[model samples]
Target: DVKVTQSSRYLVKRTGEKVFLECVQDMDHENMFWYRQDPGLGLRLIYFSYDVKMKEKGDIPEGYSVSREKKERFSLILESASTNQTSMYLCASSFPMGLALDSSTDTQYFGPGTRLTVL
Candidate 1:
């Protein structure tokens, strides 16, 4: 099974502090993603990297950015952590098991998310 690791399970930061969350995947998959889940609203993507040094902004990329210096590791950076940014951050990866998405049985497996609490 593919294993994804998050740098933290919980983080508490004061407002305006820069925050960094790290993620690593061992599957050597071609895709890595970062998302934040909030109450009422479902998971919203922050950014995704298909390969090292390659990144695409997801639905919500405002206050957040990502780095993929190595294929096995991806990092999410918050320029200024705020109370509004306090949410569950999840990291995910996907790989092709066979051919197409449905036929390949490729599914995104998420990490045990990091919960951020800002005051």
Candidate 2:
């Protein structure tokens, strides 16, 4: 089965600290994404990587950046954690879009999520 692994299940931090959340996927999928999920706001994309050393800033990437040094691993870095940044961060991966098998059917398999509590 395809799998995505998140490095942390929970974290607590003081405001202004840098934070890192790691994710790895075994399937060699070409698309990886990081998103923050809030109760009423749903999932907001933060960053994504399509290939090694390449990254794209998503809609809400102001406080975050990412790295894709290897095909199987992706990392999300919070330049400076803040109380308002506290939320569940999820990592997901999928095959490149527009495949013969209907890639839209691709449901992003999520990590357990890194629950960051910025104090």
Candidate 3:
């Protein structure tokens, strides 16, 4: 089974601090993503990396960045943490779904998520 783990389950930091959230997957997946969930804003993708040293900006990437130095590891960095950035951050990994439209193969396994609170 593919397992994803995060560096922290809950994090608390003051404003203007730098925060790093790490994610590791047991399976060698081609795509990894980071998303933040808020009360009504829903799950907004922050960043994703399809290959080592390659990354793409998602819907909301203003205060976020991502790194994929290794196949199974991805890191999400908050340049300057702020109170408005407080949310539940999720990490997901999925195999490279080819042309086949099977949704099963396109499924992404998610980690427990890290709840970050910036004060």
Top candidate (lDDT):
3
Looking at model 2, the pairs that clash are none
Rank list by lDDT: 3, 1, 2
Per-candidate TM equals 0.91, 0.92, 0.93
**Candidate 2 wrongly placed segments (more than 4 Å):** 99-105
Stretches of candidate 1 exceeding 4 Å from the true structure: 96-105
lDDT of 1 at 19: 97
lDDT score of residue 61 within candidate 2: 94
> For model 1, where is the 10-residue window of minimal lDDT?
96-105
- In angstroms, the error of model 3 at 19 is 0.3
**Per TM-score, what order, best first?**
3, 2, 1
Clashing residue pairs for model 3: none
Report the lDDT tens digits of candidate 1 across residue range 1-119.
Answer: 67999999999999999999999999787788999999999999999988899999999999999999999899999999988899999999877456334532568879999999999
Checking candidate 1 for backbone clashes, the offending pairs are none
lDDT of 2 by residue, 5-114 (tens): 99999999999999989999988777899999999999999999989999999999998999999998999999898989999999998877664265544567777899
lDDT of 3 by residue, 43-110 (tens): 88999988999999999999888889999999999989999999999999987777324554778899
lDDT of 1 at 17: 98
lDDT of every model, 2 decimals: 0.91, 0.89, 0.92
Cand. 3 TM to true fold: 0.93
